[model samples]
Target: MNNKEIVAQAVYEVVEEQLTLAEVERLLENPKSVDHGDVAFPAFSLAKVFRKAPQQIAAELAEKINPDAFEKIEVVGPYLNFFMKKEVISSMVLKEIAKEDQSFGDSNIGNEGNVTIDMSSPNIAKPISMGHLRSTVIGNSISLILSKIGYNPIKINHLGDWGTQFGKLIVAYKKWGSEEKVKAEPINELLRLYVEFHERAEEEPELNDEARAWFKKLEDNDEEALSLWKWFRSESLKEFNKIYGMLEIDFDSFNGEAFYNDKMDEVVTLLEEKHLLQTNEGAEIVDLEKYGLNPALIKKSDGATLYITRDLAAALYRKREYNFVKSLYVVGNEQSGHFKQLKAVIKELGFDWSDEMVHVPFGLITKDGKKLSTRKGKIVLLEEVLNEAKDSALAQIEAKNPDLPNKEEIANQVGVGAVVFHDLKNDRLNNFDFSLEEVVRFEGETGPYVQYTHARAMTVLGKADFTVDPEAVYALNDADSWEIIKLLQSYPEVVIQAAEQYEPSVIAKHSIKLAQAFNKYYAHTKILVDDEQRDARLALVHAVTVILKEDLRLLGVHAPNRM
Candidate 1:
């Protein structure tokens, strides 16, 4: 156990007569001011249990308890404050970080557990846009968090590769698309054709019937329709792979809605067997008004399946195939109703494990306070945004250090890290405006600042040739050193909380706080001093480096050693 856990356990031993260990741990909190102490426990909740006043209870407890783990304890009004041996905590935290290195904050709490995460379900024949950024990075970071805690995470890129959209593409391709142009520039050409189809269909309303007929033919597996569909999918994937490579994202499964097409029949039959299906204007649906949701449409009047049908089939398939402990859908909050109905239908089908399924919804991206819409073509492509960030980073590097080695590689890391870190730093439930200028700034609580802090620590470590001895008396003689040590000792707890709460922003904020503390400490003290302070201060710098790197990794951002 770490120093905080040891201290908490020690406090439990002191107050075992009045409260359980869990309750004591829950009540233990970090003091806001340095003068208050390292940790504090409030006596307000225990007054009724002990049948005494809060101040009287605190004074009595302080007088009776004789704990050896802490250096001192005092009762300040209704609060019981604790102070630890500074040298002991500093030595313990530094030694633990040095021993574990990159894997310092990980735990085995989720051993042998399986998690399947669904994210980044972009439609075929359309380029990935800035709107898809939240789902992709948020899901990726959660997967990393789960894996750090020993859960086997299965990343799935559930592509949107079905529906009448493909029929519209097919109709547009035959009318205004050429084979050479499509083969040369697939996504752009397909987008042009798609845009043209909507434009012309406004005047030619019969185009809707033709599109529907083409979709029916494709569903029937017509050779001509299948050929076009396969080519579009193949070309789109090639472009998608380039983007994924740039982002360093990988998926264990690329199964999309089309993959579940043949599997949806069993769902319809099961719904019918359970008497969950109802007729609504010649359509098949599950009446969910009683459960405070709109009817879940299973099949259209024309016998075509809907999106929810495929989702239900996919959920069942994932359960039987992986038997996951948790299956998470990381999508936009606009689909909240769809997931509620999905879970309701699953529960009505007699599966009690429906609660294991989770829908992790996030807010949308906006430009100039207006929502970005892909259907109307008023969207920014993700590729362009990333490239722009890279260019800006390169320019900044040129201005700061024109002769730096491996400049291009470092620029790529800083650029991508800025964009990703900006998104992850905000609460997922709150919408954020996209601004390239603000995200890549080098000062303040930004990604480049954190990266620069790591680089600064690396430079200091390089200048010092002393060894870090955990057994030696490393005096953290100043408040700055003690502040940094306290933050370092709390890394493992912060990581665990982030994973449990499904919040990457927690880690983001923690990293920035640590960076700020270290920068202040660095400004006041010199690490390469001619004394015992050299080894002790270097040890602190090393611990800070290890923690910042791990935090960045959990947020799906890269930490560069030089910036």
Candidate 2:
């Protein structure tokens, strides 16, 4: 139990069960300052039950409560502030962390239920750009956070490998692209062809007809079209894997839009049989007028399946395969209406689990206040950004600790970590401008700062040759240590909060706070001085390292032992 629970239980027992434990817990609040106390209870609610003034009620309750768990309980301004026994609380917290180590925040709240996360679905034959970063890292971090609490997270990269765009690429390749050029640089070459097709199609509308014809041929498994599509997919995956490798992210499934080509017919057939499909301007759609959404276009006038059709198939397939407790689609916020229509159509089909599908929407990452666009050729390649970040980290590390071992490896961690941490530190739905220099810096509320603090702790432990016995007296309960202790004690609750909100920012903010507090503690306290509390101080340092690493791990960032 945390300090709040302890105070609530004490107050409940003293009140003769006048307020149930849950009610007491709800009434408990943290004091504004350390001088007030660790936990405070405003006596306003108890006045109705006791028929007394709040001030008098607080005084009487203070005297009635047991003093064993707390050092003292002070009554002030109709509030009872409970100050916990510092030595006992600190020792218990440190000892618990020492015992738990890396598994400190482990829980079985999910009961091994499966969660399917559809994320990082970069279009095939296009370089993975900064626009794709949010879904990739955010989804990866959420999966880690959920898994820490015992949920089995299945990450699916719903690749955009099927579309009319492929048809355009085929036309461009046959017209202008050379096999040698494509083999040398597949993504860049394909991206150029794609842009050129759009530019030319503006003047020559007949090109669109030709592209559509090619797409139909490809859909029907024409030998030449299928061969080119396969080759494009193979080369695109190779490019995407390099970016994923840089971020150290791996997906459980790579089944994409193309995979649902055959399955979408079943969806269309089901909608037709259920009378959900309606004709509008020669196109088939599911009317969602009652749900306040646009009609879900199932098939275009040309008889091609749309994104919703493929999505419906994918959703049904996931439910049948994973039996997921929660099916999450980590896509951009612009498509929220699409997801709403999807759930509406699924609900129309009489499946009660439509409510289980969740659309995890996030905001855009802009460069110079403009959204990056691949067709315009104004895109920040994810690989180049990561490489630049790594170089920045290497330069900083070289200046700070020239002799540090494995500088290259450590730079990789800090560089990639900086980019990921920057993206996650913001609220998920807030669009923010990006700056590479600001992200990879070692100072401020950045990934490297937290990582450096963690490295500092490890260095201290190494110098002291600290080994946790799990039985030593951790009795350093000074005021400076109190803040760090509170943070260390609250990690488990933070993990649960992150999981519940489907928010990675919760964990990221907590990591920043813990790092800041420990830095201040280090500045004020003489940790290595020879005294009775030396080992206790070292133990505190050890606890900080363990929890810091775990925090970073949950955020999908690594905490290096040296930096």
Give the winner by TM-score. Answer: 2
lDDT of each: 0.87, 0.93
- TM-score, prediction 2: 0.98
**Tens-place lDDT digits, model 1, residues 1-563:** 55546656776776787778778878888888989888898989889988899999888878766666677888999998988778777877788777788888889988868899999988888998998889989999999999998899999999988889889999999988999999898888999999999999999989888898898889999999999998999899888888888788889999998899899999999999999999899999998887899999999997888889999999999999999988999999999999999999999999987898999889878888899997777889999998898888888888887998999998999998899999999888889998999888889888888988998898888777545564655556578988888888888888888888778888999999999999999999977887867788888998899899999999988888877
User: What's the count of clashing pairs in each model shown?
Assistant: 0, 0
Residue-level lDDT for 287 in candidate 1:
89
Clashing pairs in 2: none
Model 1: lDDT of residue 548? 93
- Root-mean-square deviation of each candidate, in angstroms? 1.7, 1.3
* Model 1 stretches astray by more than 4 angstroms: 2-4, 466-477
Which stretches of model 2 miss by more than 4 angstroms? Answer: none
